[model samples]
Target: MEIFLALLGFFSLGLIVWLLLKDYATPALAFISVSISVACILLILEQLGFGVGAA
Candidate 1:
């Protein structure tokens, strides 16, 4: 699930960057969107306790 979320975040970030460069739109929207995605990914990791070992 962590891998999935990471991939999704990466894809979203890439899309935002592409749009910003191709459409010449303000990067503010892209930055905000990417930030939200990153936050979500972090939240998911925390909820899953990914850092804790599965003894």
Candidate 2:
């Protein structure tokens, strides 16, 4: 499950880069996308027992 989330996060990061490079996303949109992706990655990490907050 951790590996899956890592892969998903990697893919999402790549997609965000691609969108920016391809001129498909505005700066605001890209920022929003990245923020959401980071949030999801953090959530997944939490679920996998590697979160920042106290248990």
Candidate 3:
């Protein structure tokens, strides 16, 4: 699971870079997209009994 998240985070960084390079999104928009996508994934994982807790 940790490995999966690590890879996801890695690709997510790449995704932001790609977006910025293409001028497809402002920095703020790219941040929002990545953050929201990660949040949604976490929610889905929790629903599937793969809970991750925040302290």
Candidate 4:
């Protein structure tokens, strides 16, 4: 899905940011990025009226 892909991209971007800030520690960056992306995707979906079978 387009939304899913966007979410993944957002997470990847966050991971990159984290890595930059933390000097390239992939593990911690990956976890924080995933959490941020999931939260952002859920929020966007809810706002768009496509969340939880509402579409």
Residue range 1-55, candidate 4, lDDT tens digits: 6876776678678766766766556677667766786676675686577788532
Per-residue lDDT over 1-55 for candidate 2, one digit per residue giving the tens place of the 0 to 100 score? 7676675777587566756654766778777666666766776676777989732
Per-residue alpha-carbon lDDT of candidate 1 for residues 26-45, written as tens digits (9 for 90 to 100): 67866766666566566555
In angstroms, the error of model 2 at 25 is 1.4
Error of 2 at 29 (Å): 0.2
Summarize candidate 3's per-residue lDDT along 1-55 as a digit string, tens digits. Answer: 7755665676577566656654766787767667665665675466557857730
> Cα lDDT of model 2 overall?
0.68
Order the numbered candidates by TM-score, best leading: 2, 3, 4, 1
lDDT of 4 at 5: 70
Candidate 1, position 30, lDDT: 61
Between 1 and 4, whose TM-score is larger? 4
Q: Report the CA-based lDDT of candidate 3 relative to the real structure.
A: 0.63
Root-mean-square deviation of every model: 6.5, 4.4, 6.4, 6.2
lDDT of 1 at 19: 62
lDDT of each candidate versus the true structure:
0.61, 0.68, 0.63, 0.68
